[model samples]
Target: MTTVTEAVPPAPAKHRDQVATSLPPARGQSFLKLVTLELRKSVDTRSGRVLIAAILLLAVAAVGWQLTHLPRGTINFDGFLAAATSGPVMILPVIGVMAMTSEWTQRTALTTFTLSPRRIRVQLAKFVSAIVLGAVVTTGVVVLALAGTALGGATSGRATSYAGMGGEIAAGYLTVALNVVMAAAFGAVIAQTAVAILVFYIAPTAWRLAGPELFKDNANWLDVFGALGRIAERDLHGMLPETLTAIGVWIVLPTLVGLWASSRREVK
Candidate 1:
């Protein structure tokens, strides 16, 4: 009987350790919290702070420009608002550019992506943060305009007309949002502060100057400022398609590229 018996395998263990269990899903940072963090990061650094201050200073400088150039009683808020935003509009997008590029140049992408493994969410948060900064700067421009309006009125002993310009305000915000978003998109694509800034400024200017030669009136399709300027004038009744086309090319296209680039961008 012993010779006939064969060794049998041990029965399968039924230990609880072998049980397949679902883990509570790993928690992630909230999108709004991500946006808030990005927003803070936008202004937390020394250079960022300086750039923001420079934006407001430019607004004040616009006020001075109005005070000196415009005759008394003609110091309308509409004009002040327009003048206040002109220089800042050019400078404001730089904030968006820096907000994105600084993270790369300063070597903080490692920390940023480590905390938020979903790179797209982080990139998007930064994008939204730049738009939010544009809004904040726009509000500052309004406040400076109102103050300048009062000062101009008092100093000139002239009546100030707000013009109750709703269209202009709306157009201003749209223009600003577009510019900042475009700037951020360029930074995302280029991933360098200086190059992004130069390209963002130069490419548009170059295109504006040279495109007319190559494409004629049709060149306006690729003219970012020309399209945006028309929109800013509240002249979208007939040019909406043209404006959208330009935006699609400059903003939507680059944004897609930037998101793709940022998602794959290597972090050191």
Candidate 2:
């Protein structure tokens, strides 16, 4: 007897058992993910690789260059460090610009902000990550600097006081960190990397120049890099208050403005 057979429909998958889980990611986790991705890209890329190498190579090269220009007996370790480090400071800001600009150029920020929807969180992550990256790079520079010093046949230690060292390292890292934060913030404000980079390049110079000339003594309060230099040197040059003000303007103002802009802008 040919019996009619009933077709059975497939059962619905359990929530936990679904091959593709439907659980939403935690909010903070998404921000962390963004930071990790940025750092990873930086570490993996040829350009990022070149950054550290270039710093080291430049330090050594500066020592070589100094040998040619400096008097025979003037080739001291401290002098070598000053010469090597001076040129590299300009490069750090460029790095800050690149960090933010690359995101838009590569379209990575779209995916990043889309996932979290909390722009501040993403900004904070980038800021923190940039500080860490800068610290690591600076540490590498310091190592290379020490090596260069040793190669120069000098045995004296760092000239700055312990207190000075503390302040110097803190200020140096903070300066680089603030630059990164400014870039990230500016990126959000402008949304175009090219425009942001141009502003970053010009804004501080204008501020420093116009500040001192226009404001007189008040200019020291407004001079961004000059204040940073004082803080880094721990010179107790009565610029501490001004340096604090500059830090507030650079680090906090840009961050607030950026976050506001990011919150308002349409996600492209």
lDDT of each: 0.88, 0.65
Instruction: Name the 10 consecutive residues with the lowest summed lDDT in model 2.
Output: 155-164
Candidate 2 has a TM-score of 0.77
The model with the greatest TM-score is 1
- Candidate 1 per-residue lDDT, tens place, 66-155, comes to 888777446678888988998899899997798789879999899888888899998899889999988988999988998998998888
Q: What pairs collide in candidate 1?
A: none
How big is the positional error of residue 72 in model 2, measured in Å on the Cα after superposition?
A: 7.1
Candidate 1 C-alpha RMSD relative to the actual structure:
6.5
**Residue pairs in clash, model 2:** none
List the candidate 1 regions with Cα displacement exceeding 4 Å: 1-26
